[model samples]
Target: MSSHVKLRKERGTIAECETQVKEIRSQMAEQLKSLDLHVEMRVQLLQDLSEFFRRKAEIETEYSRGLEKLAERFSSRIRNSKEPQHSRKEQDLLSSVSCWHLILNHTRQESREHAVLSDTYSNSMVVRLCHITEDTGRLSKKSKDIGLQMQEQLLKVTSELQTAMKTYNQYHTDSMNAEGKLKEVEKLEERHMGKSADPGLGQSGVDAKQQRSSTLKKMERLKEKRQAKFLENKLKCTKARNDYLLNLAAANAAMNKYYLQDVCSLIECCDLGFHLSLGVTLRLYLSAQSRVQQSQQEAVGVLEGAVQGLDPPGDQKKILEMNHTAFCLPFRFEYQPHEGDQVCVVSAEAQVRNELVTRFQQLQSRLSSVSLETEEVNKTMKATLKALLDSFSFEDFSSSDSLQTSQSAESVKSSGSDPPGNKPNIAKRRANQQETESFYFTKVKEYLSGCSLISKLQAKHDLLKEAIEKAEGIDSDPSRLQCSNRSLRVRKQRPCSQYNHKLFTGDLQQFVESSGQLIPLVVESCIRFINLHGLHHEGIFRVPGSQSEVNEIRNAFERGEDPLTDLTDHNIDSVAGVLKLYFRGLEKPLFPQEKFQELVECVQIENKLERACHIKKVVGCFPQAVLIIMRFLFAFLNHLSQYSDENMMDSHNLAVCFGPTLVAVPLDQDAVSVQPRVNEVVKTIIMFHEKIFPGARELEGPLYEKCMTEEEEYW
Candidate 1:
């Protein structure tokens, strides 16, 4: 009975729900049709505005031409009239008519151009707004569809529940009916037993009672099974409903998050576009300023020339006043078309230039205001983004945040009242943030399309480009030739060698700062210099700078001039070259290039004892002075590394750049024959460089292997 009642209730609810669904579908369809109509209206509005501007321009042109024709007819009538007294007055009236006509034409042209520009800007703004509205409309439609889907899911679950309840009822009724018949039969058996006391009849009655009890037990088992099945179906329906709800909530949240993220991204794009526009505007402003300044200079020059042409005996103050008048008076027009026309054009140009300067100043002020507004908008956007990030624990918006981290119904139920996936506070905060974000993006779009900020910026850029071309043309003019003047007086100059005298003074700090990694080239040059000069055994070397200049520099230093500050690039190179030669004069050559391979091979031995013995033997072959100098060089490099990472002179990398220079081939052999030797010496230098440098640690195993592999290929 309960099952039948549930079935009836479900049947009634389904029809009602279907009617609601139909109503909702109709409402959504109407909304979509309305949105389409709105879009079409916006497009049509733009078209109408465009047509209005076209008609306005045509009217202005026609009006200007009509005025010109009227002025001509008036002038002709005045010229043809025979009245002498009226002739002069008519001539004046005709001149006024011509002037008025010109003014009307100029004003009309300016107004028409301004109107067209304004219409274009307005049209662009409308289009941008339409795009925003369309996006919102789509979002609304998607939300409606999700609602419809949820309704459908609820109805399906209701139908399944009705069927399960009906099955449960049928099983239960059958079980109860069996028990009722068994009770009736037992009462009948007691009445019959009192009339017939036969043993066979009594046994038959006992058998009948036993059979009924068995039937009752079977019915109870069958009912229990049906009840278990019904319970399972109920749990399934409940789970399905919960899942549907969770999915709907997740979808809603996801859409909101997506919209907010897109808005943030759009805001960022706008910020970038604004900055780029500002940069372009700034360039144009600078170019315009330059051109204006140049024009002003030319105008001032013309005025100065006019001043110079004035009577020489005139009073100085009067002459100055006359010059000012000459500058200001030329913009006036003469009806006679006299020689003053050229001066008038020039003066008019000067006035135009002045106006341009004022306008440029205004442009700069507007740009600054725009920049400040853009910055404020960006800050607001970032703050909203930060709030969103804080409220929702999303690692990144680059992927689908909802799809990847959506919580199932089971997880939500397990987590109890406060599910980890969705927080009420967070959802509320996100909604607020989303609203603010939409408003900000709307503002950003308004600013972008406002008075055509981007278009104005582009115009400025084009103007700047044109100005640059003009400037370039002027620069290329043949009239402005570079003078080939030269000074005849002699001055004391430093020799290259004198600058290098300090290299052997043992100033490691100066060496690192000046030469950096160029130390290798300097060293190579120095070594070749020593070899060429046969200075290997010399205890002293001549300084390279001019003697007089060197003495002067020394005196200045003695007078407390700082050496490092005084050092120049040439001086640094010369010092490095000199230092290289100092190595040749060592008690033993640093690498002992003659035995480079033997030394490296000794260090490469597998047996520690054998390797140590061979290294000792190789060291003993060189003079003790060479070992001392090698240690000093490595320590200096380590110190230099601390100061600058460039010269670095680290064990592995320094060897690569300077390796070949360190490898000295025999006089009778070419470099190719000594390639193996160079490799060995590079290895030897790196090995000892690590061991001798105080702070050096053994190379990491992988890095050491990579270095060795590179070295083999390099050699």
Candidate 2:
């Protein structure tokens, strides 16, 4: 079956054939030696005869197997003569029928056997001689035919050559006549030198050509350099983008882990059950509601920052109108409220956030520096502060070892098994250690009683430090060297707002770009988490990207076997890749379907902790404080301001990319939100998606309107 083996077989057969050819030729020669004839003609006839014989053998060989099969099948019938017959008459049938069949089969078998043998051996010799003879004959016939064709072609060529020769001769004669005229003209020209016109025309043409050539070369060089610089800039941008993405991913991963842990701890702490009343429960709920709304407001603020940063042109009056139209689609759901139900929730929510925000501002103003550091700090403290505030009883400051001993004593008293008349023994035992124990308790009580006075002094010192710092930063003296020093806020300044301004023209665009940059990194992190946790779409932390959202339009085109024409083409079924996944702690409702709920929890945790610790929305992000209390307090506040959940979809009826990064969450019909984060998410996603796959927003008018409305409300 292998090629090498088959090739070897073919080669061996050819060699055997050549050997047989020599033997056949020798045998034919001996037979021909007896007849006298022309050596070449006799040789040709022998070859022809052999060739005919070989061809007959080849024909038989082609049918050899079929003949053998037929022979084998009929041989048994011929031998037995007892197989089924068509005729009714069985007697007097000649036995020679069997003999005749046998003879026929023998002849067929002989024919096939001879063919195989001759084709395998004799045929080669016969074929070779016949081929040689035929070749010679064909050569002779061809030579004669070629001689006739050549004569005709030669005559045609001779005629053409004669015509050409005559033309050349005539042309040469004319050229000689022209030369004589030229010689006469030359002599005339020499005699009349100043008679010629158009002198230096050729030179001028040469100069013009040279100038054009030089200009082309300069243009080519300039174009090449421009193209090269463009390519270099593109490379630099790509690399910068990659670096930014990597850093963003790392920072985000660390932040999210810490955020989740803090949220879980804080949630558990806040959920701690104790003695409660209806008023207290209501108060907690109201506090929680306000905290949630403030989060929504701040999230909107962040989104607004992002939108303003993208540097959108301010002449967007028409754009704004269109955006509004897009957002103002008719309500489609059957349970559409009479506006009261929705308004009730909105109004209560909004009022709470506003009130809470105002209170926080008031509280901040009351900070005389000490209270800023310590929420429980007394504003008008004196040396008696220790007696009034910092003082604690010995029992309140009891050591764990002492408390354990007291508990043990109570347990023993309950047992009531002490011997009678042992009062003297017990008194003697206690009398020795009473002085030492009393001394210890007294020292601790004195320290606790003296603490408030020290604190008051410390508070006063902190107040002075803050005043000095604030005064140093302020430019109250207009005449001072104002020319040199710059203010914190400036035109095109550094430490760019991490939170994108969603309204200042470019904020939404900036949010989109910033989040767009985040997407790839987020996707990679998602993949990494999925792998590390062995997670599917089951619970907390699912895969975040959606291939369908990314390539829905392309998918249609691919199905149709046509090229996708545009990104935001009406046929686009998807607007983004994965935007929803699990936050680490809240494991229920994992995928996009449960995104709204998870978002609520993430934002809720972010909110409660902020309210409990007096963290406000104005400075909701992280604080510079290194203390654990401050770190956690402001950390939760930072999360709350993200509007991670509070301001997201209320209807829960749309596709949302629910992750820490995406601004591309597209809110759908009946989609409600305490805040309209999805609108911004969609805007950001579309903008960024387009940067890679250009012209995505071939139909972005509606999106702009929806996003603007949501952003406006938040702002």
lDDT of 1 at 312: 23
Model 1 clashing residue pairs (backbone): 495-545, 495-546, 497-544, 497-545, 498-544, 498-545
Model 1 Cα shift for residue 332 (angstroms): 79
Summarize candidate 2's per-residue lDDT along 302-363 as a digit string, tens digits.
Answer: 65454344321322232234334321222211211111123111111232334433433343
Give the Cα lDDT of each candidate. 0.38, 0.31
Question: Which 10 consecutive positions of candidate 1 have the poorest summed lDDT?
Answer: 702-711
RMSD of each: 37.2, 48.9
Estimated TM-score for each candidate: 0.26, 0.13
In lDDT terms, how accurate is model 2?
A: 0.31
Candidate 1 lDDT score at position 574: 39
Kindly give the number of clashing pairs for every candidate. 6, 44
